[model samples]
Target: MNSLVLIAVGLLGILSGWFFYSRFIAARIYQLDAQFRTPAHEFRDGVDFVPTNRYVLWGHHFTSVAGAAPIVGPAIAVIWGWGPAFLWVVLGTIFFAGVHDMGALWASVRNRGQSIGGLSEKLLGSRARWMFMLIMFLVLLMVNAAFATVITNLLIQFPTAVIPVWGAIVVAIGIGQLLYRAQVGLLWPTIIGVGLLYGLILLGNAVPVALPAEIFGLSDRVVWVLLLFLYAGIASTLPVWMLLQPRDYINGIQLFVALGIIYAAALLSAPTVVVPFINDQVPAGTPPIAPLLFVTIACGAISGFHGLVSSGTSSKQLDRETDARLVGYGGAVGEGMLALAAIVCATAGFATLADWQAVYTNFGAGSVGAFVTGGANIVSQGLGIPAGLAATILTVTAALFAGTTMDTGVRLQRYVIQETGAITGIAALKNGTLATLLAIGFCLAIAFGAASDGTGGMVIWPLFGTSNQLLASLTLLMVTVILARLGRPVVFTLVPLVLVLTMAIYALLLQIGTFLGDQNWTLAIMALFILGAAIMVGISAVTALRQTGFSLLAHRHPAE
Candidate 1:
């Protein structure tokens, strides 16, 4: 199929889901009442609980969750063929991911914007809360490790992206300072910020930055990783308005503009997908399509991590209950759009089927590189730009995507740790700086220590995906419980909950066996632990559902 045709159809399907199906859930199922005062109103503080513009909040939620995972997942999963990957991205986003995100946000908003971990104690008892938070902590660790490796590798691979990626952060800090400190109007300042960012991209191409052979006797890649984590520590430590929000909003705009250019180029060039619809030419030792694809494409379709962002930060800033549907569900659909663009670039970027096969035959950090190269090639071919500069732009885009997620993951992980410490009565762990240090330390250890190849991102991705989806399943269980307890119909949340729970368990079990066979003892043990936690959480969910009864006419609604 032609890339443009595929894109147009995918866009139509997503729009239909957003306008029709999502609207039905919001109005009839979720019953989002605009009259309800949100947490942002009740806890209106300028630090973490400020009331936000719905549009800017959506941008924040979307970019933070969208990350490089969506691109990397679909980029790799198309190994099964573009057909299955595209199918899951479209259907999963509308049915599973969208519902999960909306339900998570809704649960948090009604609970005074508590994290999902916080809700577990109130809804599922203290033990289940501990188990859920433990799983979340591990998942975020993997996220930080993976994204740090990803960002470092991208900078090393595309040296031109180095300047632009770093420059954007500096510019974002300035934007935040002007907006929050100087009281400048949003429009002109934002336009200037974006223009400067693009200008850096061009200037970076002209004078690409390359590291010397050694930086204080360490390899450049290692030094880059260290610098990245250091930046993450400082950036994630600041208040949300100082760094995360403004930076993500700018990156979100950059992503949207890049998407427009890519699709317009595809429409004009009409690139034929050299990769087949159903690829049968699987190389030796490649995992089967069933469970692998589900885990591989976690964020593009449905991600549990989105639950963390929704409940962790987004819910805390929600201005009205009705905006939950728009920000939560809409942010997920926006991620699906980004995933579709990735699939297009991955499947059509190569000149021939063999070229596509060569890159995708093995799964690793390089899959992201493939997407960047292919996307740059496609846009360059159609728009008549230099391939090198185009590649630099896409590389910087991917780095920014990964960088935002890394910063946010560290912050979220620290919060989870501190919350866990508070619940467990460990006063020392509750210190913010100490918690942040612990978060960064764990990530660095996993990224540099356990990864034999030093590309921790690829190795831990399967773990990340399984843990991420399992967390989503657990989050959905909580969402189902909240709905049941609220006297609302539970079908919308219940259905996806069951589906993700089943698939994630199946994948985790399969991964456990695979890791055992590969002699990857660490992952095997981790997978087994997550699976055990899931079983416990699942038992609790089933017990709660039976007690509450999944009826639309629930007579005993819990206190809101």
Candidate 2:
């Protein structure tokens, strides 16, 4: 298959989904109102709840939720074949991810920017709400911890990315001041920031920086992880405008440019996909592709993490209730495009079947490495960029994206902790500083405690994938109940809810048995806990639905 085919088809599907499907969702299903008083204005604190431009908010959301998953998940899942991964990426983005993300945003915005977990108290009862928070902690912990390790490893692997990765922070801080404090418009700040960022990338490519093997009596990886958490802790405490919003906006723009180049490379070079549509070579011990594919390709398809980001942060910054469609659903579309890029690159970048087979010796072999290597090959071949520079560009892009997600993940975890404080009557945990420290403590403990190399968090990726889907299903379940109470059509959200819930439950069971067979007691125990909580949530959800069956609440002016 020609690479251009994938590019054209992916773009066509994404554009149609954004133009037609999301509009129908916004107007009919979500019933967004331009005049509705958003929580951003109602609770404008300049910290977490500032009214933002929809484009900037979308940028923040797109990057925060995009993370490394869209690339890693789809890149790895294509081992089952590009056909399955490609179909799931496009179709799931349209039907599953878009709705789940948009509905979570709308639901939270409708309820005063309450997190999905917070909304659970009323929708599913306090017990379910507490359980929702637990799942969130686990998900966010995995994200922050795992992403920190990802960045550190990337820094080690591509030292050329180090300067640009770190320099991007200074640029973000400057951009933040320009937009928020300097009283300037976005145009000049954007031009200067993006120019400076790319300049750093060029400089980084020329002058690569690698740390010594050890620093301060610790390995470079450990030190880098610690520094990353410290940065996240500080970044989380800052106002959104200062770091999160501007940084994400800049990173988002850079990524879009990167996507454009990679897609153009596909058309320009027209590389043939060397891999088969469906692989006959089943890697030993590879799980049955049925449910594992869904979990493996979570974020790009349908992620519970997207729901968390939507409700936790994006809902708080919604400029207008109407912007939810663009920021929420549109963000998912952007991620879908990223995943499509991963699929196209991973399958088409290789020159021959033997080359592809070398990397496919195992199920988990080709992830970030595949995307980066393949993307670099395409860019170098088509765009005439040096191979080394192309690799730096891609690696810097991935590392920066992972960093922003880590920043947001820590802040989201702090919100859960402080919310816990409010619920448990522990005032200190509500303090942002203490809450941040505690969140970091938990993340670091998971990282270093589980693995001495500070890579322990990566072990829970299997749990993270399944539990993330479970949370999405739970979020959709809440949205379904809300629709049932309001007496609107429930088929859209309802169907996806059932599908994701079934897959998640099935996948978790499979993982548990694998863990037991391998004597990996930790994941087995955590997986069981998540499974039990999911069951409890399911029962409570049923009772909640029964209590609100067939009500006739008006959609136009929902009660606050």
Candidate 3:
């Protein structure tokens, strides 16, 4: 098929969804009101709670939630075929992800910008809320470990990305200080920051940074992982505006530019899809597309993780409650666009079928590797950039995505730990520094604890998808309950909730069977735990719904 046709269809679908579907959701389902005060204004503290421009907040939310999942997930799932992947990415983003994200943000904003874990207590009972926090703690540990490992491996794979990656951090810190401390306008400073980032990319391409093969008897990758954790530990504890907001804004701009180049290349080069529309060559014993495909393409399509970013960070920064649709739902559209770009690249960027198959032969690192290379190929072929330079550009872009997400994951995990501790009456765990250290330690242990092959994230990646979807299901379920309580039509959130919950449970069961058959007791046990937590939360939500039959419950306003 012509690449333009595929690109046009995907882009059109997403745009139309944003214009019509999302607007309907905002007006009818969410019923956002600008008259209400926002938590950012009510709790204006310069630290975590500060009102932010909608555009700037959108940048932070999008980048934090985008991470490498959208790129990696769709890249991997296309192995099933382009058609199924494309359908899920488009439809799922519209109905599932956008609604879930917008709903989560709405819930948080209405309740004093509380995190999802905090909102659960208000919407459901205390038992479900605590269970939600426990699940959040576990899921975020996996998130931090996986993203840290992924970034480390990317830097090692593309040494040129290291200097640019670290350089951007320094630039971000400088920009943050100037903006927050000096109270300078962001226009000129942002331009300079972005210019410096691109300039460093050029220099990094020339003089790449790479650690030696061994350090203190540890492999280079291991050493890099440790260094990454150290950086994350510090970054997560810092004030939000100082690093997280400015850094993610810069990264988001780079991603947009990258997307522009890749899409232009797809149009100019117009490489045809060598892989079939529907691939029947999936590995033996792999689960069918019904549930497995849904989980595999979680981030780009619909992710529970987006809710965490929405409630945990973005909610506190939003200037108005009505902006949730634009930031939360619109950000999901941006992600869907990225996913579509990946689909176009994966399906048509390669020159031949053999070349495509070689990269996509398996699911682990190769899925990520294929996207970097395929994207590079598109840019190089279309923009006439040298192959090496093109690869360096995309590689650096991927690293930035991973780095931003890893630290943010740790930061959110720290919040969950502190929240859990306070709820459970564990004083020590509520200490900020201690919570951060514990979060980082657990991430390091998991990342380093995998098989000797050191593909810990890859080993746990399948479970991560299932867990991620389960989280989304629970978040949507809460939204459904909230809507029911408010006496609004619950069909919008309820339908997606049912579909996602069924898919997640089905996928978990299949994973458990496979892990047991392969004698991988660890994954099997984790799967069981995820299933149990999910069931517990599900039961709680259903019971709450039954007891309160769509009656309006007294709600806490943002001013409270």
Question: How many clashes does each candidate structure show, in the order listed?
Answer: 0, 0, 0
lDDT of 3 by residue, 322-349 (tens): 8898899988998999899888878787
Report every candidate's CA lDDT.
Answer: 0.85, 0.91, 0.84
Using all chains and alpha carbons, the TM-scores for the candidates as numbered come to 0.96, 0.98, 0.95
Report the number of the highest-TM-score candidate: 2
The true-versus-predicted C-alpha distance at residue 370 of model 3, in Å, is 0.9
- Flag regions of model 2 displaced more than 4 Å: 550-560
Better of 1 and 2 by lDDT: 2
From the highest TM-score down, the ranking of the candidates is: 2, 1, 3
Q: Give one digit per residue, the lDDT tens place, for model 2 in 141-208.
A: 99998999889989999999999999999999999898889889989998998899999999999999
**All candidates: CA RMSD (Å):** 1.9, 1.9, 2.9
The CA root-mean-square deviation of candidate 2, after full C-alpha superposition on the true structure, stands at 1.9
- The order by descending lDDT is 2, 1, 3
- Lowest summed-lDDT stretch of 10 residues in model 2? 551-560
Off by over 4 Å in 1: 363-366, 451-459, 552-560
